[model samples]
Target: MPSADCDTDHRFVKSKVRLSVKVAPKKRGSCTRKLQVDKLHELSEEFRRELEVRLDNNEIPDQDEDPENEWQHLKTILQETTGEVNGFSSRKNKDWFDENDAEVEDLLKTKRSCHAKLLTYPNVQAAKAAYRTACSTLQHKLREIKNNWWLALAERIQSYADMGNTRAFYEALQSVYGPVNQVQAPLRSSDGSGLLTDKYSTPFWVAGLSTMGTFLVTIGTYKSPPSKTYPNRK
Candidate 1:
C-alpha cells in the first residue's frame, strides 16, 4: 500500500492540475500611482538624518546588545517615514477620469438643489440658468484636464526615451497599456497522467519542456510528403 504522505502529495498534485485546467486567466490589477524618484530620495535622506539623531540621543535600540529590539525599532521608523513621504493611506490613485467623475457628481448635486428651489419658486429662471452653466463648465473642464494629462504623459515618455533609459521607457508604456498577466500551464497530460509520479520521478520544472515534447510526439501524427508536386495538374 502507498504511504499516507505519498497519497497526500498525489491528491495535492491532482487538485492543482485540475484547477489549472478549470480556472480561466484573470486580467491584471489596476496600477497604483507611485511617488516620484527624486521625492523618494529626499525622503530617504530625511529618514537617515532622523535615525542618526535618534542614535546620537541614545533613543534607538542597541543592535550589539539586542538584535530583535534593534530590528523592531528600524522597522517602525521605516514604516513611519514611508507613510509620511508616500501619503500611505491618504493618497488616492486619481487620474483625470476619476476627477471628471467627481466633478460630474458635484454638478448632479447642484442640479438637484436647483430643481428643488425651482419647484418652490416656479417663476425663477436663475436656478435653471445656473444648472445649464454648470453643465457647460463640466464639459469644458473635463476635456481640458484630460488633454493636459495626455500631453504631460507624452512629454514624460519622450524624455525617458531620449535619455536612452529603455527600462523607464518600457515602464512608462506599461503604465499606459497595463502590465501583462502570466499564468502557469498544468502539469498533467491530456491522458490524465501526472508529469511526476514519485520522488524518483524527474522534477517537473527540470523536464517540463521535454515531457511536453514527448506528449506532442504521442498525440501528433506525421503525413508523408507527396511524391510529385502538382500530381493532378495533368
Candidate 2:
C-alpha cells in the first residue's frame, strides 16, 4: 500500500478484520418432518396402527452397541414410518423453473469453468476475456429468470384471492416482502484477542488509524476515504 503512488499525501484506509464464528454443536439423532396439518386428524388411528406394526418388527437395540448409533437408528425408523403413513403433499412446482433451465445451467457451468481457467492462467488475455463474457451471459439469463418468477408469483396470488382462499392469499402476499435475513456479528478488538464491549474500543480504533495518516472524511453518519475530483472543460 505504501508503494501505491496516486499523486496524493492522503493514504488509503486499510482495515484488518478477523471473524470469530461460533458453530453450534450438531445433535446426532435429530430429524424433522412435514405433513398435511388438516389430514392429521383423519389419519390419527391409521398412523398409530402403522407405527405399532413397524415397532414390533424392528429388533431391540443391543446393550453393547453405542447409544448414539442406536438412537439414530430409532430416529430413522420413526422418519420412515411417518413418511409411509402420512405421505407427501402433491404440491405444484413453480412454472418459471421449467423455463430455460437447461440453457441457464449451461451458462452457469461455463462461467465456473472460465473462472477456474482464469485463476489457472492469470496472465492469459483469452482466459480473462472468456470469463468476462461468461459472467455477462449468466447475469442476463438469471435476470430473465428472476423477472419471470416475479410475474408468475403475482398471477398465483391473484388466483388464490379469486378462489376465496383468504389464508393462502395473505400468505402469498407476505412472501413478496420476503423473510428477514439480518445477522449481527459480534464486534471484536483489532488484535482479535479481546471483545470490544467498552468505550475504549472507539478510541483505540481512531488512534490506530490516525497513526497511519489515512485520509478519512466524515459527513454526518457516513465515513469514507477521500474522493478525487477533477476540473472539466466542456
Candidate 3:
C-alpha cells in the first residue's frame, strides 16, 4: 500500500509539472489577425440580430421598436460615431460632396422636353442638335461626377448663333413681332404699299430674314423695277 501511494504521488507530480514558455507574437501577422477579428466583431452583432430575426422572429424580445428599422438606426449611429472618431467629418470634403451631389441632381432634372417651345423656330434644328449633343455629354459627365461640364457649356453657348438658338431668340423676336401683328388690323398700312397687311408681317418675320427678303422683292417688283444694269447686258 505504501508503494502504491508513492506511485500515485509520482503520477500526480508528473501530470501537474508545467513548462513556462514565452512565444513572441509576429507583429504583422498578429496585427492582421486582430484587425480581421475586430471587423468580424463589428459586424457580428448586426448579423446575429438579422439571423435571429430570420430564424425565429417570435423568439426575439422586442422593446416596442421595429427590429429592422432599429438595426438601420444603429448602423447610422455607428457610421456617424465612426466618422467622428476617425476624423472623417472633414468640413471641406463634406461640403464638396454635397455640392457635387446637388449639381448632378440639377443637371439630371434638365430634360430635353424643356426646350420644346424653343424648337418652333427655323434655325433651331441645328442649334437643338448641338444642345442635345451637349446635354447628352452633360448627362454622361454628371453620372460619372466629372466637374468640368459647367465650364464646357459656357464655352458652347457663348456664340451669338447659339444665343439665337435658345428661347431668348424667340423672346426678342416676339417683342418685335407680337404687338405689330397681334392687334386687329390697323386702318392704314405703315408703308402704304397695300402689298403687306400687318397679318402678313407676322408670317414674313417669323419665317426669318429670307421670307422678309422675298416679301420685299415681290412688293418692290409689283411697285417698280430696280434702276441697275448688268455688265454683260443680257
Candidate 4:
C-alpha cells in the first residue's frame, strides 16, 4: 500500500480466507493516478505557496537552453506540489452481487491460477487451453451476475418511487447516474435570425426572441401612382 492519504497508484487487495473457499489478489496493473481535484479549493494555498518557492529557487531550466527540459521541470514541480497538498482519490469498489460472492471469489482464484500457469509454461498447449477456458467461464458468470443485479436494482428503485420515499429515490437516482458532467442543454438563435431556437447541440445558454406577442399586419397597401390619386385617399 502507498501512503494513507494516497491510493491512486495502488490497487485494492482483498485478502480473506475461508474453508473450501479460494482467494486471489486483485491485479495492480489497472491502477491510475487520479488526483484529488475536488480538494483544490481547500488546499490551493499550500500547493501554490510550495510551488512558488520551488520556482523562486531557480529550479526551472532555462527556456533558451532547452524548452522541453524547462517544461518537464515545471510539470514535475506542479505534480509534486499537488500530490503533497491534496494527495489522491480512490473509488470504493461496491460488490455487484453479494449472494454470489463466494462463487465469484472461487472463479477469480481459478482464473488467476490459469493465467499464472500460462505465463509459467508458455510452450505448453495445455496451459494455453486451460487459460482460455477459464477466461470464458469467468466472463459468462460475471455477465449473468451483473444482469441479475441490474434487474434487482430497477425493482428496488421502483419500489422506492411507489412508496413515496423521496429521499431514498433521490439517493438511488444519484447512485445510478453518479455525477453529471455533460453541459446543460442550451437554447440559442441562428447567427442571422433573432428567433429563439431550441435545437440539437445549441452552444449558447439562453436566448429570447425580439418579438413574442401577436400583432396585425398589412402588406403592399395600394398606393396609386403620384399622378393618379387613389379613391380611398382622404
CA RMSD of each candidate after superposition: 16.9, 19.2, 37.0, 19.4
Which pairs of residues collide in candidate 3? none
| Model 2 misplaced stretches (Cα beyond 4 Å) | 1-80, 85-106, 178-234
RMSD over all Cα atoms, model 4: 19.4
Which stretches of candidate 4 lie above 4 Å from their native place?
1-106, 180-234
The estimated TM-scores of all candidates read 0.53, 0.41, 0.18, 0.36
Scored by lDDT, the top model is 2
Error of 4 at 104 (Å): 4.6
Candidate 4 per-residue lDDT, tens place, 1-234, comes to 222222122545667776775688877677668778888998788888988987888565345578788788788888877888898876523447566889899988898787777667879999989988988998899999999888887899999999999988887777677755788644435564443554533433332222322111222454567796668866
Candidate No. with top TM-score: 1
Task: Give lDDT tens digits, candidate 1, residues 1-234.
Answer: 222221121322223333445676778888664434445665777767765665566566334678787788777665555555554432333465764677667756765665456446657688667656755776676688799878888999999999999988887787777657789764665456666565524554457678888889977876677787665765
In model 3, state the lDDT of residue 144.
Answer: 60
Q: Tens digits of per-residue lDDT for model 3 on 80-182? A: 4344333332221122236577766665455333243234442667656755665776667765654454444345545534656776444444433443435
**Candidate 4: lDDT of 162?**
99
Clashes of each: 0, 0, 0, 0
Give the C-alpha lDDT of model 1.
0.64
- State how far residue 30 of model 2 sits from its true place (Å): 6.3
lDDT of 2 by residue, 159-214 (tens): 99899999989878766665457998766657775545667677777777885555
The whole-model C-alpha lDDT of candidate 4 against the native structure comes to 0.72
